[model samples]
Target: MSVPTPRSPAAAPAPTSAAHRTLWRWHFYAGLFVMPFLIVLAITGTIYCFQPQIEPLLYPGLLRVTPQGEPLSPQTLLERARAAAPAGAVATTYTMRNDPRASAEFIFRLPSGNSESLYLDPYSGAVLGSLSVEDRFMKQVRLLHRALLVGKPGELLMELAGCWTLVMIATGLAMWWPRLRESGVRAFAMRPASGRRGRWKEIHLMLGASLAIGALAFVLSGLPWTAFWGKQFKAITTAANLGRPGDAGAGHTHAPVREGNHAAHGDHRRHGGTMESLPLSEVPWATGLTAVPVGTSASAGHAPIGLDRVVAIAGSRGAGAGCQVALPGTPDAVYSVSCFPSDPKAERTLHIDPHSGNIVRDIRYDDYGPVAKAVSYGTSLHMGRYFGLANQIACAAISLGLMALAITGFVMWIKRKPANALGAPSRPSSPPPMRAWIAGLAVLGAIFPLMGVTMLLVWLIDRLVDRAAGVPSRPVRQ
Candidate 1:
């Protein structure tokens, strides 16, 4: 819904100026562009927030198991899962749940380059079911939330939308600040007798102001997942030893000693690749750049330590149940075990030498750099995993609040717009002060290059349209 305008009583003390008009115009444009995508993100994100509760109901037989005395060894369960899977499906990772009733899950990569998860009864060694990795309902929702399920192009589009949403929030605050100044608490008051548009405006302003901080957190936390800005940000932060822990910054207890050809780089080489290169499922953001250490083949001629030994090794190193172990794929591959707990402080990752069943490298939450630590907690809070159900409710409320803002905004626009023309706010006689414009451009360019480029392009197009229409241009004042 529209913010309190210059003529509105809530903003009566403030005279309409170039800055006010300019901000309103930008607020309108940003909202218009971001509304649809915001709605989609809110819906999918809300649904995904409750995935822990929903998925169990959707796949009770596969996810849940009755603990019958001592459970089968991990190696036995892996073998049973492999036998039940499609022929030639190689087991890549095994996830051990802390809950006694939870079934063992094994991720398998089929010969056709597709991945699936097979759930087995931990006690009986019986296969319960299998699900296509990409086709799962929650996975599809996540895809839509991140990329609109259209892949890389959609990912880029969503990133742009997210960047513009920050602009929308900034301009919206500028538009609403006058009302807050003039009316104090009364500025947020709803006027039921003031008609439908007034009601929508009240709801929109109230929710928008209330949820702005949370919305910012969501956008900023989710930005780390974007295809373009995310990679650049990761690289930049990693290089600065702020986002991801480097060799000296990691503070890992046991750094793996490289042997053979890997010795040139010494212990814990920075491979400049993400954890995705390893067979990991749900990795922590802080360790995303932590390189996978290659194993020495000195003991490779001996029987390779089996999955059971790897699990025991991880447990001995404090990575107990709930850790997902990525089985070594080659002679030089080390078994990667990740314990991604709901509590960010307990997050840990370990690499075990498959040949000697020795801990190669061990990284805990403490090993992360300051920025990386902040991001780890931010991501957990963003996903509503930090404080349990209450956190979920809070996150869901914010998502629903965003949806309400979008819907109310649409209603306000529909009622205010003329049938014959675009309903955008009219431009001011003069642009915003030159210094303000320059400062804004600098901030956007430095923080969000994509938005800065597009913003300049939009400004150029507006200037061309003004020139074409013969509108006299007034110089921006200080």
Candidate 2:
């Protein structure tokens, strides 16, 4: 069989307006560039949203245990956990729950350069088995969601894609704007047609519009973690008069303590029937104090509080579900108990003196600043736990819609061919102005730092390519 010749350039049609052509060209190319990233994000996000339900099923043994005898003391559990680890490694124990049937977990770094986790019978202190962090389904899904199975660069790329997704949503809305007035319900509603092209277009427009808000929410919430948005958020929060002045050297600052009897003190020394407070700096051991262990304190010479006592104290103190009891790390360390009472709410961080088992400080959710509260809620929203079943269902719906949007977009792009090169018209054109294109690009770039940088890079590359192709440079309209 004879090989067919390629179509001649002369047979192609010319673009209506150079600017309209450029906008469409960029849209097509950018969509192509970000498609893989988009797919990864959608898949990972879908998996991550179901983690609360899926994780327990995947690691049932890791999450629970059968009652044996009286629960082991937190101190005893710590020692047992430490003994299980290799030399020089520190053990972190979580004091799980009061149900003798409930399991407690100890996490520690092994000499083999891997972290090891073990589930134990809280009552008998019997080690259940070692767990591999890598073997955890949720961990793997989270990694894929945040980093695309790669490291920092992948994370950055994902963030960039997230930013671009916002852009895509906006552009898509602009493209869909006409339908708002003309078609009403049919435009906003899903109405699949018989033709392949019609179905693809319908899918693209309807799904994109439906998920636009959700996609924007995810992007805006996630931006706080990106370098650019982190700084921007800091500035915005500062300017909004939300929190106290942040320390120049510190990423955060504590609200100044009120000048009443509740001021923070350094040491717990006994004075005239009261505690003799020292400057935080004057307390030599305070400098080394990090997270207090669940039931031990520095005042007690950093002796480990027995696991049983810690459990008793936590129960007595009404430590709610999802509470974590962290062990004191150093000589002056206090055991810290952190708990979240509800979804989309802040946590309570409580420090207790190990020796006396007295509560040192209690920081409730309401005590946190607005930004801190926002951060907590944003995290909950990201995890799809902000509102309960309704929120989770909404997230799942959005993820499915996003997947549909992306697939349909790709199909639509594939279905349409570029205009012919020799000034033929596929159809008569009503092209948008160059100024409109510039405004759209500027708005998109302003909202997404990565898009701004990418736009600059694209312009530079286009300049170089045109120069090499002996084509004259087109002046950007003022």
Candidate 3:
């Protein structure tokens, strides 16, 4: 996901032409729309990147425990959690950590359609209290970062803003490209003595040029999370066999039905057949679209395997500490075990049968297709999970740098704007050729259709407004 460093504007000769002004105008509008979102994303993203350190500090009582005797069995923890849970709440997942001080987490789906994470002391099996999944600080921040605290509509807005950010970066880089001078190491020099507008302009330029790659990384890596484009990307990758293997409906297995419970087994398969119906949370990206394989049929005269046995099964398959085991919701649902390791290469997901304690489906990093593998690593890098503390620091720096860039851009605009004028760059006397617009549209549409549609609509609106005001249209350059 790394890109080559762009040449600094200080290192190249400045291009000061009407074309540059045209590019500036585009950059200005894009920034005007994108800056606010960038600021919010930066602040929220920075907070979420340090969630590992921050969550423990914020919820020590809920997450920490005293390691007295040997830890209680996983089934014991689950039983205690279920007993403490609200009436009619169903256990969905259990998170076990190898850390002695860490409490085990049991996620439950309430009858009222809400989800809650119940913490339990591993050794004492004491109920440590439950937190509604929606109310968790880091969870809310993540939702905000992706969807602005709103739902689908907000997600689309964020996606559009993200797409426009690419445009903003492109136009900004274009405006920055010709400003290179042979200043060598001094090319990045800034002058605080310059007047207010000059200072802001220099700050904006330097930050924009320096952080363009990082900004691109953030936007591109995040595109897969967008509601529209992300779904399409997932579908395309999966269809091409370059993503998670097996179809969404391809992984289900019917359990062996008891003589009197054949109808119940049929009902379960009929109702809970799809992956979407599973109460899975925080699943790995590669397995997002894949179905959770159904467990074997509930057998008569025998009890289903215990949580400790499932844990042992996952451990035998290389899913060690920090693995989340999603308990079966229906009699036909398998025990879903997933480990999102800090190293992308170590990511693993296993679906173990609840009846026979057999490994139904085992997906590991090595099973991912090339594109899926790249995205796995890219996603890890984007969230600052890979490489541990260093990754988090780098991501935090990028997030903060983007915030600074947005602020500086806004400041420059404020300083340069006249009392009654919008300070946007003037249109070029010679309009760009039709082919240029067509080519730009084609390129953008191919890569990011949503952005291309928005850009085209904006262009049309600009033309309509200009024509309504009797603005003369210049001839397109040949």
lDDT of 2 by residue, 1-478 (tens): 9999998985644434454345544555566666777777777887888866776687677667776656666667777777766686666546456555467777765666566676776777777777765656666776787776678787778777777776566656765667777888678886657654777777777787777788888777766655455546555665674522332112222322222222122343311110002111011111112222232334545444555666666656556656766565555555566665445343545556556555555455555557756766775676577787677778777776777777877777655544542111121144346687678778878766677898789768755765576644232210
Task: Compute the lDDT of residue 375 as modeled in candidate 2.
Answer: 62
* Descending-TM-score candidate ranking: 1, 3, 2
Name the top lDDT candidate. Answer: 1
TM-score of each: 0.89, 0.74, 0.88
Alpha-carbon shift of residue 290 in model 2 (angstroms)? 12
Best by TM-score: 1
Ranking 2 against 3 by lDDT, winner:
3
- TM-score (C-alpha, index-matched) for candidate 2: 0.74
lDDT for predicted candidate 1 compared with the true structure? 0.79
lDDT of each: 0.79, 0.59, 0.78
Better-scoring candidate (TM-score), 1 or 3: 1
Segments of candidate 1 deviating more than 4 angstroms: 1-15, 192-196, 247-274, 298-301, 466-478
lDDT of 1 by residue, 1-478 (tens): 8876566554433345777767776788889889999999999999999998999999999999888999889998888888899989999989977789999999999999989999999988988989998799999999999999999999998999999989888888877888889989777776463754777777888888888899999999889878989888888887886776664223333334342233432244422234666667688887776677766565446468889888877776678777888887777677888888888888888777777666667777877778778888888888999999999999999999898888888898887777975566656775667587579867986888888888888778766876777655332211
Alpha-carbon RMSD of each model: 5.9, 9.1, 8.0
Candidate 3 RMSD to the correct structure: 8.0
